[model samples]
Target: MSDWEDEAEEPSAGKQRPRAPASTPWMPPQSHKQRSYREEGGDQPPTRERAWEPRGQREGDRGGFRRPEERSWSSRELPRQPETVTGGGWSRDFRRQEANRELASAPLCFRLDSSVVGTVIGRGGSKIRELEESSGSRIKITKGDYDSEVKIFGSSEQQDKAKTMIDDLLERYDERPETDTRFGYKEIRPSRSADMSTTVTAPVKRGINWASLRENREKYEIMKWADLPPMEKNFYKEASNIASMSQDEVTRWRKDNNNIICDDLKEGQKRPIPNPIRNFRDAFDHFPEIMSTIKKVGFDRPTPIQSQAWPIVLQGIDLIGIAQTGTGKTLAYLLPGFIHLDLQPLPKNERLGPGMLVLAPTRELALQVKAECSKYTYKGFKSICIYGGGDRKGQINVVTKGVDIVIATPGRLNDLQMNNFINLKSITYLVLDEADRMLDMGFEPQIMKILIDIRPDRQTIMTSATWPDGVRRLAKSYLKDPLMVYVGTLDLAAVNTVEQRVFIIPEEEKRAFTLHFIDSLKPKDKVLIFVGKKIIVDDLASDFSLQGIAVQSLHGNREQCDREQALDDFKKGIVRILVATDLASRGLDVHDITHVFNFDFPRNIEEYVHRIGRTGRAGRTGESVTLVTRKDWKVASELISILERANQEVPEELFEMAERYKHFKIKKDSERDMIPRQGRWRDNP
Candidate 1:
């Protein structure tokens, strides 16, 4: 039987069944799987199936199952929102916003009952200003023949407040809108609550497209999800439960295997999006402006992620993308956002409230995302990067003035939100990049709060290098029926583009070892040095400088301007080496970084992967050398696995070192006192 078919019909050995509670999350039913399998005429379609599959995949798939510790990142009082609110027209419609969120300045437009429109608007537009000031918002009352659209512009808090005040004012006229007398029809009104305000008033297009009624069912493949019949939504509703991974556990997979799991696939099962277009010419056939902009930037072909991702995103599917850094993941999300905006533009003259939000784990990553956005938005797209340590007034001014895209760190975003510097009510596209790190840094409360405000109508896209319990919990909490895409191995490991080497040396000898290796690198090649602490980063940089090596340091202690300058210098080849803590590991992307030197080997493989990922990105070949000691034996096995996969030689001595700590481990209740193993090494001479 094929992977799509039910193996349970002829099972032998025990296999774990998917155990996630059906009520908490949604998945396509098994009966539908049977039907899909039977209907599919041919054998398993030829596609990119590789290193790892979903956690829930059974015997047929090469599933890597590791039960994460049971823990809740949700230590809050926020009420759990139902997946789909039941039996309320306004409630259902509120969650289903159809506005052009790409326009940051689009106002909240809602229909006010014609009977009470006069009461809310008041004479000579008098009450509008009063309502605006009282709720810290701007209001515009545009009256139609029977109903009026009371447009609101402000922070979500302000809009919610103003909507409430308007609702209370309109309470003076309790009677329903008067029935239309000309048609002899008693008003068969769609039910609506007073407080509800929808951003789009455009009539929803209905009826089947004749284009989809062709021979051989060709139209079914090309039809956009937005234009698909109502039943199509339900068809894709039942998909697999999406989750995340931890930073440790080394698994190296190739990018050529761009497999994506959709609503039609079972758990751990993935199928690449069909008809994957190769270049801009084909992919952007419908997106001419975007195609022109990309061509101007000299992009001839879309990266592996972009080629597969663009088609799915263009279909308006909520996506969870897993691709290595420097693979153009930013453009994968941003380009789609731009295309969506172009296709369904916001009303002209709207104020600047970002319709699309890209949340990154760190300031550096946020800035990078913004920089990439600027390139793609060459068609007069404006964006701002928000993080702490920059000018607060400048951020507030630019954001409030208006921007098409907003890239921000969670902490600074939370700060701006509290001060009413920005509003996310109309945010249609949400991208959470490096989501696991955000949780690792304890930004759960801030992320959760932001989600609460933009709960309904938002299309969320979360991407992370590894899938940890935290990321899994987050995916469960916010996303609905999201499509999970895995370009490489889902397991945590270094990017395949880098050549790796590990040397077992004493801790005190690491300095000399790194210096020896540094002397061998090309003078112009940028080298990144990773240490465990900020003090180590600074001390190493200072020591390297005193030794006549041009090096710079980056960590939390350095001023924002200094950090930016350090990165700038490194990128420009003015600085040859950069010493940094793990802060620069994940999101820091610089092209042509020839080498990554690990002065102090990290305790886990996750840190190792992220550090090396900085070097070999965007199809560039790079090298990573690690100075290991007996203390790092816990990670030695995984490190060996990485070395073996990369076709690099692993010294047999590594096993000898591994035996020292692997067999007789340190006991938690040991009676002996802990002492540092200061290795005896030859002096600097």
Candidate 2:
């Protein structure tokens, strides 16, 4: 007689079923017409009643339905649907039901592997949210266990839709550049407590504390030249002088100076290492195969660095050759590496493995260096680049097989070392090209570790444009009293080929000013824009692209693929303006660059030289424009010193601002009763 008792009741139209109240009552329904009619129709009386029902309620029942003892449903509020809507215009309630149904029916859960989940989620989970909306299904990632599993829930049809969506997403995810998401092992303090099992603490106490650490650290410390001791001071001064001294100056210095040690000639040698390649002219020069390979790669004439470094490297002299970028630095070391390998066969011992170790700061540079090595590696000389951003297992396998030359970045090399894949004991020639930049990027410590791992007696070549303090210290520590062949502070005057200029603009108008400059970039003129920050590189790149400018950006933040593409695009002249950070300014040789713009001035004076040096390269006439704003006057002043030393004229506006700031500085100094240095602006400006 009751709806609860009518479980087997037949449906009449789609009419609502009448039932007892949710709560228990003392009496049954007062209106018995409807129920008595059902009783007259021979419906059986209720066989069971709620246990909490009162006696009066049972008597008043007259076989009518009584309220149940269970909690009432009418007072309870219905659940609110999720705010998110599906792509197919399904309401949140319908979507939730559909998701539940899908989860119930789904045959198997698909998994996606990623070390980074939070990054994939992005801000506000917009990426996943967008995917859900477009797929007409609900996709829910499980709780953050760092597990790769993601749940796709919807109805069977919606589940199928979600699966397809998920599959497509996985494909895109796989196609996306792999991010370096390694947070590394957590640092845990060593604990003696047996109960503290979670902590993996190691006791690192030493007899000496801060002072000892400082003293020991300084023992092997590679500081800038200025921080070196008085006795070690002259070594760098001599090195700087050697670097600055021209080829003729070097010839004179080596002739007169006996205290300096020449790696090849010893104390009294007059000439660079004798050309070993000349003796094997029949093997390399006259031989049609080697000749063709050389010709095809465009080795018409040897560069100064190449000419000097090759013979010494070939002769097995531990020479340190300092040279500017694009001056054949790769070949300076690569040819030596090749010649060294060419002269001798690999030892039978497996430990006597790779003969060459060339370290660069970037994967692109590593790969590029390896590419150069490949050109001359025809005679069973195999070289491989062990760099990140690619398949590491393949590189590991190559290392296992042994290579003639191994070019790699510090981090990947460190990784290889951690995995026990790299054996540097056999490396005979260690070349650190772009040494200064390598030191600048905090690679010195890892590089030192790598050097220490290798045979110390191995030939070491540390090459750079201007030897910074860090580089000098690294050279002093790692390199023996090595042949320090420096090409001196490579100023614009030293490189007469590059023409430079400056444009004074306010700080606020930089983007617009950059846009105007980009518009002026002609088709054959490759342009590189240097920014101080990585984010600005991205922002300007995006802004330029949105304005229909086919520009590419290169920075440390970009994926390796993106960075490569930007470089390729610039190389191909498809993208005229390359927005980049200071990282790209060094060790990158794009000869066709006609314009270099300092979208932001460099942090140091040396970087400005390199950034502008990218243009007017390989003896081509080029232009560099630096937008000097009022705020950048301090940097501008430092830059002017280098320019002045190089005989390049500083902009008149910069000079005037330097003078004005000098007056203001003097005024402030006087107001504070501090005596300012005399002839400051006048001395320079």
Candidate 3:
């Protein structure tokens, strides 16, 4: 600063310092000139040059300066232009080209609320980067005070895909509440579109006789309980109270039999739930042929389910029977169905279709029910079993011909009904067997479609081993004031007759353990080995075959004939060991199965119960050995609870494994919570 002041105060040898005009406008000082002069040589001073001097005065009149107004406006000639160019034409053309370029390169823009920006961006912009990579777009979020504009630079397709992804993400986020355990905070707000309602109306189908259908339904309802003959009414009343017990006696009886009854009726409207039949004569004293069939099968009084279900079903009431597999559920429904079919108000000739319709979840179950119908012959009635993977033409042939009973899987039955090959209007007795399994297989839509054609006044009987929410919903939707007869607690429990044992082992050791178990089996011992995957069923079956063990494999991938043959062989003891997937978990009835080996634990606890139930049947004690690994820790706690409820020993390792998994899950959730997340969006993007 001292040197600069010295230089400014004193002039150089041949130069004089010029003073700034008092009225001159302030101009920004150029330090670059000083820097250049100093860079050249600090000893010499910089030259003072006036940049605003007119061109005419610059060279010819350097001694004096002229004012800007004195100079002529048109004194300087403009640069030459081409012949085709006009005033500002080139400028206009340049601007037009620039505008077109900008239009072509413009990015896609959208707006989102400020709060949800962090959620979209994720921790450290991970979610945005993922979107960009997946969509082949460059996303830039320019945040404002209240909102943000998302600019996506990509082709039209990429931009559209990115937008769809973001929309889907936000939609999913809005559907489930967000919770942070660390702060004990939860976002319980409703979605932005929660207030919006969408109403959809289904159009009526043409070419259907609405009036005739209504008339038929009215005629069917005319045969209700009040319309039954006096003699038949007396028989129902006697059968219901034949084994009557005191309130205390009834409670003790239910507890001893492990029966849980849930009748959906008000206290004033409730009727006394029937007690169990003491013997075959208690309920079927009037039906000698049924008594003969029961005697020929064996001297068995009646299973708890059959005992209680017969009276309620016989009284023309809807029944929901929940019992373990192999608890004579089929007989409970079949006998009532036979009686209902025989007692139809409309005679066989007057009826449009079969008198009874049995909906099974699987082909095997359908066939088994058909076999049961065959076993207990009632009035020489003809029955047909139809399912997918079977001969469709043959099924249609059987349906076209007169049949009294129709047992079918929902898919095939729906197909037949849709094609007008089967008529459900005349079905007076309906039975939905294995209702839980059917729902599990996603047959609800088909079941609904099939049920639509059946008369609403028909008697409905639904049987299931487990009472899941889906089955409950189905029952509520279809059944009218049904009485629930559960053999045990509604919670999933295996047959108490089966002894459950679990072994915690590595996945690789499963095959060895199975082989060892097979070696230990007695000559008469029949076992069913359950695996998780279809390929594993084949692999294990082939491995057992290589070991010279007669094993039959059953899975969904097999042909219908092959599956039937395998099940038949297993039942007849041709193959003592049956290896299968969960396909055989339900509806597989083999009375002689002495053991159930779970080579691989099932994916769910319900399947596990069904798998073990395959072994113990008809009061015969059996055993089940399951192999558990670390990967199955998700179901470990549930397995322990099932074991404890059944009074079976829970292994110490299972408890430890469940505890470790719980800790791991907690740590994972905590780490996931550490990620950045924003507040709810005011409006969707």
Candidate 4:
């Protein structure tokens, strides 16, 4: 089982490089004329009959005249050769030397298969180096528009020697069967190439591309824990299963199951996991001035996301953080900024622009970042929160004064940048918080435009609860050599402490069912309801108010001041029930939400996670109920797949309906809005 194997010859295999062009002349030079064939055979030997006459026939003086086949080294005696060599290296092939000289002047070229170029490079051109050394020729491998090839050139003798070595290399290279490599797998080859016609032989393998594998290794590593092959189906299935399991359940399962997996996919064998945190604590501790600033803010222990990410960021590597909401992403980037800032200080008067820019999806989330930043704002280090909806005059004033960090929403930040209220060119560190939400909200273009205004050499960091396509693409463009940190998959529902349940109800009884669900809530149980439309929000809020339940509505249609009031009241528990549309589903940071009621099922499963995420904050347990109508039964079942992946329990009734009508589509009138008509309800009242 040799690791080096030439791929089997097959019609599907890619074409190989052509043979090296033949050198025109193959003869010795005037300097070495004595060794030339012409010099040795200038005078022909005598005829065999005459030479073998009498004495030779009788005594073997005719040794040279023996049968051609009998001229064996073992049987023949040594000849008395001349002591001195022939004269002046007898007549050389001056023409051959002239041809070699001309050929060496021309560019030496040989084309190889593009596919095997990587294998030939062999970790910093080691394989290529070996080839050049063996062939006694200077080599240059180049990739261009048409394909890739290698070129060699040297003195006439050296080039000829190189040509022979290349032929042998290609012969050995072409013998092995083609095998694709998975990530980190290594193999060897007898020679650089197998095809004698071309020097393009290299062992290749079929598996994950290194870039893709490196980007998604955080996820793939988990799959390896299950001892599954590196397939998409395997990754998704295991990710879902792992996502659904509780921490305790996963722990117990690992102890009992023989095939339990970890992030790197090591089974039976423990993997060499790197230190989760770089010396961030040491960095903070060594810089007492910064430590004083951090300690004053109650920075005792690093959060899970912080523990994994800060060290990598401080190490100045890129990062892909994969933690859920409320995991303290602010500190993850903030700690690194502080460490970097403390180490490299700037003059006070010169701090007119932000050193770090943290972009959040919404004003509230941006404000939240600023608030978190405040805790660490000691010893002249400060951050300003900037977003629309508030007084711009004040925001401008704050920006004008200069701050160490600026936490902002994309649109507002752009507005300020356009107005010349802030200078983005000075930004050294960039952070995109809740990247999935920003992208989902259609802030990508503005985010990109803002990034374009800043320095390209800046350190960029992005945090997201979900790894959506938009976020992934943005990460590719913005970050360089990022260290990916994935705590869990995005669609894992009710993470930490929220019990997700669904109730199947008829469409006609939807409102009544919601009322019943709300009535069941105990006193002071803060509940958040997620609705699809703005009209439903108003109707639901009215319905709850009339029902003697303290509630308020928050949606995009409302005036900015009014929306703020509603959110503020909800946060204060002044209104225990806050009915909101999708706007609040993402960056609304009210931690006291005890229950989240999906008065209507979300349009998609990802929305479902965001809705439920509002509750279950700060280690407090929360509960969520999805009021599913007959029309939603099918979608509910599809939704259960996500829940099951998150390891949440699905209601049996919902599952049963899905099982019965798996192929069925729920029919509904286009006009059947979740928000009931106001006239009839008001007239009845």
Candidate 5:
């Protein structure tokens, strides 16, 4: 595992740069002979055929990464490699070398052979001094300092010219055969670039290329976790019970397990996983720090999504993991992501955009991911969580310094990028944390724009509870050879981890049933109550407070600080009941929560499933109780389907009500219409 690896000529395992010819300064008297950056001797025997891996950042950089396969290194035979021209990106084929005064400066180092080191730092360091002035960059002449490595530090253009100068200087002094490097340099290679057109593009539109995303999913590369090599596999090896299940047995198991059905999956040109891991340790064996962090977080095993996603991501493959909410989906990516970081640890003080970018849909989820990052964080690793409602200047200050990982919502990440306050050129890993929600909330334009900023060669990981047509289309555009993983049933079935109940009550008496249910909850247990609208969340929290219940409500409009505090209070057991709108539905992982109450049913099954997912996490048994009224009848059937999926008993009346409202649909009117047709749906009423 060398500290550095060469970049891709083809779209290799992950986005890494070609061992670019060091930018040159001298013209050869004759047209120059050339060679690959790694092939120093044209006729020399090839060094052991190397496993392709992620590129390492230069010393003092804070953004480096390596995957599992690339961690082997022989320190004795190595020289410090200069940073690649493209920063191991997938965005563009080559650097435009545009004089965008905004691109920050960094020190570049090239290790010189011991023999010619004296020639470059000639009499009294005069040659090195002269080279620096000509290139308009600072050149440090490290006299016998391996760490210094004849370093050139400054803006990108200056570094390019400086490298060229060094190459020429070396050529002039050494009569030895021209080795692995070229007497020539190539401009950056070609890759996808942002077109930057304002007009709507076909690929960015919803459901535009679903045919590709909807093809057979089973055709993807599938490998068993038990079958991997000693270095590649997890430490704990028990043959998977899943492997023994026949295709029919798998379907039967999924019927009760609340996992994605093979039938529901349509891999968007699946990047095959020859051997996907099924445990937490195998996917994260590269680094001890990550292993320590996982234990601190108390995650004993891999969730369904984690097991399948680990190997593909470990190999630097792009991924789209579609799993139900609260299945440790966050950790599935984060832990293995740690292994990737270990594979190519960033330099101590990197001064560019983060190598890893995680785009979450909501602010809460972003904060949650940030918290998880803290728990599993490595000592050299740095990250910033940015979203709206936070201090913009504060976030900007963090971005200017550079980071290893960025956890952000689409809008904020895009805005910072647009304002030129942040850079994405060097990013090697990109994650669409909740791809479905981002698209559903009309973030395609922002997401597409962010996609362009990243190197086109970066590894992309997208996760969602439901794989909608639009998200699939978005996946096809950004991800290349992504392994699509389904953890739970792709349908919006409630997680089988929680027990479910439906209580049919009249609209006016619904509050009584809710009160009765609340009274029945154990005194110490935490509960989450969901309402459809933001105002109702506030109203219910207020009413429940009067009823002597300790409750806090959350929604989109609250200040970021308030939402953070509320969630903290709930998780700390200060608040036993937290009421909220759909904002709290997707990813609120409070392990002690014992129940979920849908006071007002959601607009869709996806919302309902996510709402209840607030409870029943980390192997905790929990319950979901829905008070079904005539107003809820229309979509009541969705609840029945999910209940059936979880093998729960669906009350007969629920089916009757679903059919009754099957022909009924809500209508818009100038006057506020009430759910009960009496209590109007507004604050004034």
Candidate 6:
């Protein structure tokens, strides 16, 4: 009979059934003599088949072979025990137990709402599986009567990591809008009440509590009035009353100082706007060092912008100073900034970064602010200027060392901020100097990016030569309850100290007119020639250099070092003429700039005002001569308005050119209206 038939036979009452052949084909067929030897329990070499057999089964066991129905359910389902050696050696089961003990940790459990449980688990449980793999833990979800309990089993580190990931996932789901399929529409969920509480055993009854999260996660405390030290609070209180002028007194003071305007004051909600300070002593009475610095710098009295801006800023109010350039707007903000830095509750050592920040539009302006900062040092505070084309690594090094003030151009500051090279969390005072110029240069996006890192409650002071729509939008977005202080009328106008002259000449005669005007300048005159293009600046600068005139050029194409040198030479009177583009139109502060020659009309009238205001600084009389051609007719009306506002002569030729352009524009619009609409031309009878 075959071995299969023999194994299938039933055994007699007392006799055991014969064993079957090994199922694996790799085992050679055993001879009858070997089978008889194994059946008699004779010692023989162990085969691969015997090594894999279940423990406690002997070769002669009568019940080793049985039908499937005879096996118990538990015996079939349970895992086979690991084989144990008869000698004194560690078993596989012992090692597994030891590993389990080492990895054992208390399971972390959290409850999620039944509605959001699917979101956490994802389809096919892929998200939960991914979380388990990434966090090195085993996650199990058990649906209870009220909510689903998520339990994580792993080491303590793994459990914490899993918990954090789950919390983040829950937060994202909480932010999503709730949808109801039965209603077939999306509805806004009402905010949870403050008194509502979350139970440990129940689902998160409310959305993620952001206030609680912030309290647990914030690394630093935001500065506020209640957090101020006793001494700093007392100092601010005393300084608040230093203005000492009543509302009537303030009105009279503002009127006397060129009708200085203050707007957007919250009448009853806050303290009354402080009065204008006549002298440095009035505002800086508590800080003798500041007063001494002002005296040392020989500032007899504050300018119009500074006079009103001082009280508002020193009172810790956000300000939008709409003053023309060169009206001491820099000092107006800088002096108050120094006091603000000094009066902060946190000391310099405790601050994460600089306490004050000044954002300028150009490298030249940034350096100028730095120079001003150097002149008025307080309590050994240090300031750094960061801009493109400078030593970036050196700037980073200086910042790492420590700085109390940072004056930077927006581009380089944004670069540093994105790369995490600078921290703005500690900035309590910020100055957007030349804000309109910054917007004109297309730095608004970069400025917005840099401001994202700064604490929102920081006091901001924005100074613009002209308040254009872009600047207004930026101010509205960033400033809170800001007070406005403008030196002159809010409408665009040049400084009154400059004599404005306009000559209507052909575009071809502009260079000759500029040359003739240069010839008329006295030996003591310092002229700033403004052109529209970089090529013009270079071409005119080259022509003047050939004529043996002491001249330098300033434009964006020039290297930063060369630009700085040119500006320095111009400021020190080493060069009598500095031909530049509108780059120098704003924040080019040279007290001796006696002449501004506009060789080419600016793109807009606002730039024209800024170009002329560069001269006539610090109560000094200066002259600006503009050469307007046919190409500049569009802006003639604005030019006329600006000239009239400044009480300067409005040339008859300018008015005629403006009238001609107006008539031409009206005719063009009429012709455009008469044209048939697209796709409707055939319908026109």
The worst-scoring run of ten residues by lDDT in candidate 2 lies at 229-238
Predicted structure 5: lDDT: 0.66
C-alpha root-mean-square deviation, each candidate: 32.1, 19.9, 21.3, 26.2, 28.0, 15.9
Mark the 10 consecutive residues where model 6 has the least summed lDDT. 181-190
Candidate 2 on 1-685: residue-level lDDT in tens?
3332344365654444455687966443422333444644645434432233434555556554455554322222234544442222222445354445433433223333334345444434566666666765566553334344444554456656755654454446456543322121122322223222342322222254888888877665443223321210110011232234455655554444211223432456545433212122322342345556667776566555554455455545567766665676776666545555554444434334677788988776787787677767556777888877867888888888877778898989988987778777667678887777888778877887787667555677777666676566556777765665545433322355666677888899988888777777666778888998988888888887888888888888778778888898888878788888887877677778888888887777778877877877666777878888887776666766766765677788888878888888877766665434563332322
lDDT of each: 0.66, 0.62, 0.75, 0.63, 0.66, 0.76
Give lDDT for model 1. 0.66
* lDDT string, candidate 1, 461-530, tens digits: 7777666655676666667666777665666656778988878888888888888888888767788989
Residue-level lDDT for 341 in candidate 6: 84
What TM-scores do the predictions have?
Answer: 0.59, 0.57, 0.65, 0.55, 0.58, 0.67
lDDT by residue (tens digit), candidate 4, 1-685: 1111122244454434223358855421222222122334553332331221233555546444454332222232223321221111121122233434433333344555554455434435666556656765555656544345555555545556765565554456566553322221232222322332433333244455898878697675455345311211000011233235566664554344222222432236543322443233544545566566666666556656665565457666556776666667767787677655554446545544667788988766776677777866645777888877878999899888777778888888899988988888667778888777777678878988898667666677777766766557656777765657666544344465778887777778888888887779888789988898999899988988887888889887787789878888888888888888877777777778888999888876667877888888756778888888776665766677767865777878877888766544322332343336755432221
For model 4, the run of ten residues with the poorest summed lDDT: 229-238
Residue 441 Cα positional deviation in candidate 5, in Å, after optimal superposition: 1.4
For candidate 6, write residues 1-685 as lDDT tens digits.
Answer: 3333354474643335355678845543554444545656687534432223333365554554433233322231223442221111111232344545413444555555555666555645767767866997667676656566666666767877987786677657566553321111111221222111221332324457999889855545443334433223123333444445577877887898888987874445765556677777777787889999988989888889987888778777889998877888899889878888887777668777888899998788888889989998998998999999999999999998889999999889888889988988778788999887776678878988987777767788899889887668666777878898888788998889999999999888888878888898899999999989999899988998899988999999999889999999988889899999988987788999898989988988888988999888888899998999998899999999999998999999999999999999988877766677764543322
Instruction: Give the local distance difference test score of model 2.
Output: 0.62
**What's the count of clashing pairs in each model shown?**
11, 10, 0, 34, 36, 0
Candidate 2 stretches with Cα past 4 Å from truth are 1-292, 345-352, 488-494, 644-649, 660-685
Query: Which wins on TM-score, candidate 2 or candidate 5?
Result: 5
Candidate 3 lDDT (Cα, whole model)?
0.75
**What is the per-residue lDDT of model 3 for residues 461-534, given as tens digits with 9 covering 90 to 100?**
89988887766776677787778888888888889999999999998888898899999999999999999999
For model 3 the TM-score comes to 0.65
Candidate 3 lDDT at 506 equals: 92
Candidate number that wins on lDDT, 3 or 4: 3
